[model samples]
Target: MSVLSRLFARHVKPEFGKPGPRQEGGDLPPHLYGVIAEFGKPETLVHAVHATRKEGYQVIEAYTPYPIEELHDAIGHGPSRVPLLVLIGGIVGGLFGFFLQYWTSVVAYPLNVGGRPYNSWVSFIPITFECTILFAGIAAVLGMLVLNGLPMPYHPVFSVPRFQLASRDRYFLLILARDPRFRAGDTFRFMETLGASLVSDVED
Candidate 1:
């Protein structure tokens, strides 16, 4: 097996209820390991995120029932530029919309009826404004999804049973031990001291 696969196999547990012979060995290879901690209350979960961040683990993920603004800081996620992208796209769309109508009225079709001027300014405003909104809305949604890497229906972390509770009332902080400084036994021991309800090695 590759080093990454070996590391994952060593840490993540198989299906929670399945019975199998436990493998005994020395230290596991380096790979991402998630340590799940269950909390009864939102405050408890928030505390766990903060505590885990202070533990020096760089790779961490948190699951919660509702949006928690402070959690972004805990995970070290920086400000998102999706809004800015949408704004710029809207500006470009507005200009494109105006040009499309202008070209069609003046050069392409040039339907001058009832002594009306070929370059009609008032007639183009409605369509130009609508196009601006449509493009900007589309850009905002697609940009956010791409920036966040969305549409992933499955994650290795979801293989853990207790982690399923994350969508409900529970909060979870998973620290990936695959980081450069990760020491399997030492990290496990340290989490135990952090008052984790149940700290277990996650295996792939």
Candidate 2:
């Protein structure tokens, strides 16, 4: 079996149950996000992820220069709720569009044009369709941004000097301090034991 597969096999515990805390370290940034371990290779990064997961570090994420297919599974990414949000937005928009036209034509104006009824439901189709598409599109964009935590100009991970290489040829795994098992000092040492070339504290 490959190294990645072997590492995953070792960490087969399905649940991210909390583990005992390690001795807290003294050195911490004013606004600390987490500790990130820099790996020279993608394999090492994947290995580190499995190891961390085994230790119940659920609030962790990985960054790589490019997409790594195996990394997706390692990260335990789940289904997105964006589609549901978009559908609800579209339904709301359609209802709003239909009601607006109904109130304007049938209730308020009641214009008797060419002996035709004011509530021309057929005419509302085009506008209703357009409104549905418009709202759904808006929801998709906003949902994506909100879900991904975008508009964030700054992040502690970016504070790392070598993190810029994440766009070039580096792989990184970050373990957030929020994790129950995360002990600032002990976690840093754990990462070093994972064969990380560099383990740095990410400050906010």
Candidate 3:
């Protein structure tokens, strides 16, 4: 073969025949982090989630292509703490704004122009309002990130090749191995009973 042709073959072969994503376990000793069951229908997934919870699995998460209000009720996560965080942030910001203005007008740079009160309470309102909003917005974002564990570019579930369909048309229920009730073989069998289209172990 000509050198050009041989080089072209080598490059093209890898690109054209690139192996599919590695399977979930890939000859590893089944060091699993969880089991994910894929369902074709959202209703089935919701039922499976409820069943799993009823069966005493605590560390569970559901992935779906779209929002489903009923799913949240099934998952039963407790109330979020973001609102309290925002409220605390707003209160702190408002207090800081009020105090800063108070110090500036009364102590730091006292100005008695037109015999106006040095501690001008009315002028502090606008800054206090702005600061309240600014801090509350910041707290809302940070609290969400902290609560949701954001900036996590990768998770063990991503290792499952079939999981990519979760964003497209599939609903998945993941029962974490860390849950006290989880056993590799038993969980796999139980998931099969939940009407899952596909149930696979996830490796960390």
Off by over 4 Å in 1: 1-26, 30-33, 178-181
> Model 2 Cα displacement at 124 (Å)?
1.1
Per residue, candidate 1 scores C-alpha lDDT tens digits across 75-153 of: 7865676777689779988998999999999999999678889887888999899889988998899877765556656
Question: How many clashes in candidate 2?
Answer: 0
What C-alpha lDDT, on a 0 to 100 scale, does residue 156 get in candidate 1?
A: 61
Model 2 C-alpha lDDT per residue in residues 103-163, reported as the tens digit of each score: 9998888888898788888889999999999999998998777666666666667779999
Candidate 3 per-residue C-alpha lDDT over 1-204 given as tens digits, one digit per residue, 9 for 90 to 100: 684344233223222122222234323334667789999999999999999999998778999999999988789776676788799889999998899999999999998879989988998999999999999999899877766666567778889999999999999999876576776777889999999999998877
Count backbone overlaps in model 1: 7
State every prediction's TM-score relative to the real structure.
0.75, 0.80, 0.83
Candidate 2 lDDT score relative to the true structure: 0.80
> lDDT at 193 for candidate 2?
95
Q: CA lDDT of 10 in candidate 2?
A: 23
**TM-score, model 1 to reference:** 0.75
Q: Which has the higher lDDT value, candidate number 2 or candidate number 3?
A: 3
Top candidate when judged by TM-score against the true structure: 3
